[model samples]
Target chain A: MSQTSRPRSRSGNLAAEKLTYAAMLTPALLLLAVFVFIPVALVIYGSLFDFGLTSRDWTFVGLGNYVEAFGDDVFWIALRNNLIIVIGSIVLQVGFGTLLAAVLDRGVRLGRTLMRTIIFAPMVISSVAVGLIWLIILDPNVGPLNAVVKGVGLTPPKLGWLGDPSISIWVVLGIAAWQYTGFMMVLILAGLQAVPKDIYQAAALDGATGLRAFWYITLPSIRNILIVAILITTVGGFKVFDLIFVTTGGGPANSTQVLGTYIYLQAFNIGEMGFANAISVVLLLIAVGLGWLQLKTSRKA
Target chain B: MKVLGTACVVSLAALAIGMPAVAADKATVKFWTLKNPGMAEFAAEAIEAFKEKRPDIEVVYEDFPNEAYKTAIQVALNGSEPPDAFYNWVGEDSARLVREGLVMDVSEYGTEPDGFQSILSDGWLSTLQYDGKQYGVPLEAVSKFFYYNTNFFAEHELKVPDSFDGLLQSCRDIRAIDEDIVPMPLGNSERWKLNHFITMLNERVVGHEAANPDYALEADDATLFTNPRYVEALQKVLDLQEAGCFQDAPNATSPELTRTMFATEASPMIYCGSWCAGIFNGEGFEDFKMFRMPEVKGGDGADGTNFLIVQGYQISAKSKYPEETVAWLSHLVSPEMAVRYAETMGRVPSNPASLDSSDQLTESFKWIAKDVSEITVPINVLDVKLENTVSEAYLDGGVELLNGTLTPEQVMEKVRETALKAKAKLDK
Candidate 1:
């Protein structure tokens, strides 16, 4: 009788522990299920149906939206623009961020704190605010930049900085670099400080100083942080919407259109829910794939 | 006995939660409108007057910015709690909503003596009609025209263009007189500005009767938007650009900034809406004159055909209190209130009776209303008439054309492709 009761009680205790764990996780799990997981599932499901936001009738067209998106020229243009932004961001944000971090970490001792604050100032400002600031500065008719250009006896471009379609994407890149480089710098700066001082001193004694020391000693130490920064930028580039929205609105003939804005136009402006969802799915896949690749590379490194 | 008592208590609590905790006597009507200058003040003044008539009906008003309002209204209508009535452009947008059974037909209330049918004309009411049923109350009549600086025209000895060729010549002459001045300042960055130009040009080239079927996408697929005249209208926009009528970067300028340029006398002329008269007056630039688009020589367009769009309130089909909603919307468009709308908003009221009632109406506003009334065929703006996707394509095409990135043929090709796809989707 004692042996049978002992085993039963142990099983009962295991069940109670399981119940407690579920109860503890219920709030957070429920929130994720309601807000994030449900919306993602709905998007995936909606991508297969042709419907509008207000349409009472929904027609299931399996893979039709994806096929249409694949054929659409605007989709291709948007994808190309997204890749351009991603590559440009990695080069400018990561490349320049490392340089700034090194300078602040080793070279600039005087007023370092002040310079650091000033460089990092734009990160706290919202993207919409940053876009508006840049818009005013780049205004063709009455902007101060144009006034200065004219004052210096030079003709500003006829279409202004953002008006020219061929160069507008690069202008966006430059503005993004100005805003996000400091964030990357601060992130990298933390990793730089964590590096052991003895490793650098040993490398210097072995004649690996200055640029050589940075390449051999400092870079290898912060490898993980650099990978993290690149991954963040890569993911962020794919999701960029608000800045382009406020500044260009994907205009000057759709020259600045990225995937996010294109999806918005299809969904809200054109009322193509299924097509927009299909585009959203593609965007999600691209972001996820790039992220996975970055993680695998980081692990290999 | 204990279970029964607990059940009774729960039932009572549920009933109490469902009931309004307020006076429970007043009916709240949620009213929504696009944000415009002075609209809040105007709505407040109107609401104050409305309270005198129906103190029991409390109107909860909300305003949305123009860009977001289009999406917000549709999304709100789909939600469980929608506004009792909302503002809408009375064309394809309202027609789509009506077709989807999202708008309530207020015809019964509309026909009452004090309702909009009696206050507004039959033709005006027809603007908001789909399938022979009225779905909206027409509030304002808006039209676009060339707002030129009288001082600049007088200084340059430039006459108003009365023919298509004359308009082009006028542009050349303006550019010749002052190379620095833009002949017609266009803000196509918003795309609707170019749509306005194209809509009038379509009326000029194809005439209203021929353009209507195409505008409605009722024409056969092969012939749908295949008219050479449609391409010709697009060419004319490029012609204006080539003639140096517009600024160098029309595609980059905002409509508000362009309006400021004209009001400050920076630009000599701008094709602006009737509402701009109020803005010009407010900005203290009263020295302005207006003219319609010149006649397209050898085209099918007739005199007195002009661009006219009617905007008004639409009742939600899901409203709990349709009678009160209709009553509130009707009261807003009543003659007394229409006069206030015209006086304060600087728009021509749909109610003709409001015209002579408002002593505060500007001289320019009065003339514009008179001119709009004389138009035999009032063409709906292209953006409002065309399907959403096609309209977007047309808008984008206009930008590309202005930017010199796409030629007339190329723009038409792009428009045709999108129109075909949109028509296919609608058919499905």
Candidate 2:
């Protein structure tokens, strides 16, 4: 064929290729609409109505749910509890996980795989089971922890760790930290391993050694992974329910009730579907906002 | 490429065609229940009975642990494929269901002349009623009664207290021997557990006497909580706590732990419900006897009264076969079924006529039945929102009061605040 005729043939091929790409994308777009977008839209829709357990008595009271939620003291308490969990998990999980990963990276020679498995074991177990296990371990009268405390001549420990309103949140936070730290450890370890050794050598050449070397070179290298870990941990912390539900039961007197459990109570217990949906909408907004901020900061870095 | 696309479409079509054939065949009835060992056995037998009666029907029983059962059942009901029939706790949970139209009105089944004898006690039937419609069959009766360690009482030469002061004196005498041995092991952890104590005390101390003549438990008036008798009754509970009559770390101790302590004779007195009769018997404790809690001194109508809580079955509104579901519920409350359930579960029957003065009845239960025939008002069934909000406040306030964090008045104030919020919600 002549060169001009060949060009026309290529153009036809390109057009056909574009049509194929569109055909391939259609299924995924349809799935997203069915599963993700539709449910989210429904949640937003439900938030505008007064749905309950038995009755479909939905009425459009504009922003009434949001107003009620803002006025409700329990919602504030739950929100505060969520904040505590988020901060606690970020500090204890990512912070400790990174430290542990760094220590392990320096080469502890004794059964490394076994130790890693042991640390990661809790993460693999279901959250409900983990909560139950901790509940027993923290039992005031029968738990071995109290027995050990007494054995050491401590005044017989009388604190109901999980049942006491003052201390239940801390116990719950500790359980969350315990189960998830290993997960963060694995993530941070992967990030640490990916850092080129040449950078460390360069740091050493500049008289930065040990702790200073880690602060200057190592942290910068794994900044993205840390940010990712924070993002994941933050969302996980905010959404925590199974562990708290099984362990403290949002007692003594709703002391440990977080936003997730509160939303559940409003929907199922009190049968305030509209109020629950409002809480969920707020949660979605918060999650998106925080996630966006994290991504933007990571991109800037 | 055109050939490939056609083949893919043909396979998808074939798979879609085959999907319905693999779908469930039998008329499936989704059933949800709290996981109880005895209840599990009872459920199995009932399922067998149901299947025998209707061979075409199939049941899918979903058992959840008791703690998560309430939330799970609620969530499931909200889902697309909700259960056809399910078990529900009595009081506000059932009331909310009935009010919301999630439960079927079983008045037709209950009010039938051929319905089970005493199929609905006036007391239990009241709980199932919302806006003058019945929703469930009474399955079990539970109430706070005084359970004493017979061995301890005998060893101490103590008789069952006839009056409220006498009961306090008994506690004092018991505490004189061992300070740690609380006469009543009131654990504040599960706040609802304390409600039993509070309700029982209300019956004795207030004796249903209202300062305002219009103060009625069932009335729609907002002045119910303002009764002086209610305040006095709550104060008495706080008094018991102040007297060191309850265990330390009341909120920390589980009901199981408290029962274990009583069973082991660590504590001499425990106020619990008739449902625990099975528990004590299962533990093979021979030295236990129950009695009606003593009346408060100088209270009107304080002669004898006992609080009653009932557990029952309800048909779901979404049931495909409403008639069949109602038939099963009617069978559940029949005299034959009631006797079998009571005998199996070690609980008293809701049917007054079923009490044939049988020797099988525990002595304490028999005595309470004979002397205290009046059924204390059920506070839990008054209003859905009110009950939950008040119960939660009662629990939290009880915990604080027991822990010396709040006074009786403060607790009452907090409860008032909670009640007002609930009332406002209901009004809206």
Candidate 3:
């Protein structure tokens, strides 16, 4: 009788656990199904047809849109611009962010809190506001930058900051870095704070001092955090639209046309929904691949 | 429990009794327009007038910003609900909507002898027609004119240019007076501003008949956009840039900023739309004078071939109340409302009768309306008339052309490539 009762209680506990887990996961799975998977499925399916924004005509094109985008010069230019932005963001945002985090964590003692707050301020501001403020600062004719340049007995660039096709992208990248480096720094600073203090004592005992200690111990210890920072920057760069849209409008001869803006232009401006969807699918894949890399790296760490 | 159950039954009974009564009493028509400075007041006035005419029909008017209106209208039209009546350009935009079956014909209401067709001319009516079917009612017409600062011209001793060569000479003279001052401030960052110049240039150089084929891309693949004169027209724009007529960074500056420069006398001249008179008036810079674009040298284009764009209202095909929508639209555009439109908006009302009594039509605006009436070739705005793909290419080409990165020939080659692709798609 005791053995039978024990088996019955065990079975009852198992049933309750299974019910709890199922109940907990249903809402999350439903949300993912509704918000993410369904939309993605629609985008992937719709990409195979020639559809317009308002038009009900959906002609079966069978990858025609993708082929068209591949052949399209603007598409190529947008992809190239997106690549530039990704690389620039990694170099500027991650590199400077890590440096700032390190300095705040160990180097500066007097104004660490103030510097951290100031650096993190831009992250709080909306990208659109950032773009507007920068547009005025970069205006060729009336901007204070030009006034200052002239005041210093130097002529500004003939096309101003955002006017030159060759240099406008770099200006945009700089503006992006100005806004995002703080966010990355904050993220990395948290990681640095979580690092064990005993590691530094151990490194000093091993005669690895200052830069050598930072390189061998501090850098390796913050590897996961740096990867996180890079993953964020990479995804953010790919998804960049508002800043570029509000600033240069992907213009000066489509020189600043990135994938995000290009997708918008095709979908809304050009009324090519299928083509935009195809480009968006490619963008989604790149983001997913980057995300997978991040996950794999994090798992290894 | 009995009391609560009884209360619930009473509420359900009340709702059942009241629902149809509310639904039957009024037909609300959704109306959408791009947000402008005085448009809200003007729409309110029209709706007020409309209310007196049709008491049973309630109109809901919503305004969206110009940049967002394109996507808003498209999405609204495609979604479960669409505006009953909406603003649209009378060209490829509305034509595409009409083709998509998103726009109602409204032919009967528009062609009513006592309706909008009676007040508007056949030509204005035809602007909204596609495949011999009317899809819209032309409400207003806009045309480009050169707005020059009177004080600047007086101080510089510059006479109004009457020919293409004279215009270039005027630029040279103005630049020579003060090399620092921009002779003309053109903001092509939006791209449409430069496309305006190309539209007039194409007419001036390629003429209507010759350019029409290239514009329509009806020519053979090898001959598509091969017209040398088209390249020359682009060259003239480059020539103006070389003459220091335009700012160093026209491609980056905004159209609004360009207007401000001309208004503040920082720039001596700015070619803008007739709608700019209202802006100039609002900005308190009324000391500006209007002039048509000067004639192109050795060109077959007719004189006074102005760049005009007609904007109008289209009834959504899915509107539940077509009769009320049409009636409300007719009342909105009636002779009485037209006067109010002119007074409030300072636009050239579609109804010719509005010109007789409008007190708000400034002298400069009056001059534009008169000048537009004299247009022989009737050159429509390029962005409105061209296919979407080709229009984008033209816009980018204008940017590259002004940036001095692409030559006229190169620009035309790009244009040809886009035009060929667009033509193939359109043909299909």
Per-residue lDDT over B1-428 for candidate 1, one digit per residue giving the tens place of the 0 to 100 score: 99999999999997887677554678899999999987898899988998998898999989999889988998999999999999999788889899889989987775688877887788988888877888988888899999889998898888888887888898899889889888788876678999999999988988878877777777889988888888899899988888888888877778888999999998888999999999999999999989998898888777888999989999999998888888888888888888888888888888757578677888898889898888898888988989998898889888888777888888888888888878886786
Estimate, for each residue in B1-428, the C-alpha lDDT of model 2 and write its tens digit: 99999999999998998776555345666777777756677667777876776666676777888657876777767677677778776766776777677778866664555463235657667666777877776666665677899888888888788777777878888998787687888655666677667666665655544421222234344664665666787788767766667765677777887787787788888887666666776787757877776777766544534666567777777777665566666656666655555555566656645765355666555544443346544422222224665666777777776656777778778876766666666667
Pairs that collide in candidate 2 are B188-B250, B189-B251
> Which residues of candidate 3, in runs, are more than 4 Å off?
A153-155, B1-7, B110-114
lDDT of each model, Cα atoms only?
0.88, 0.73, 0.87
Off by over 4 Å in 1: A1-18, A148-155, A291-301, B1-24
Those runs of model 2 whose alpha carbons end farther than 4 Å from true positions after fitting are: A1-20, A153-159, A294-301, B1-32, B47-63, B72-85, B106-114, B117-134, B207-224, B300-303, B318-320, B351-385
Tell the DockQ for candidate 1. Answer: 0.71
Task: Record all residue pairs in model 3 with backbone atoms less than 3 Å apart, i.e. clashing.
Answer: none
Comparing to the true complex, what docking class would candidate 2 get? acceptable
Give me candidate 2's TM-score against the actual structure: 0.86
Candidate 3's residue-wise lDDT over B1-428, tens digit each? 99999999999999999998998899999999999778999999888878887889999999999989999999999887899999998877988898889999987774575577677788778888887877878888888888888988897788999987888888899989889889889988788999999899888888878888777677888898898999999988988888889988887788889999987878888999989998888888988898888888898787657788889999999999888888887776788888788778878778756676777678887787677777775788888888888898899999888877889999888888899888888789
Compute the TM-score of each model's chain A versus the native chain A and list the values.
0.92, 0.92, 0.95
Task: Please identify which of the two predictions, 2 or 3, would achieve the higher TM-score against the true structure.
Answer: 3
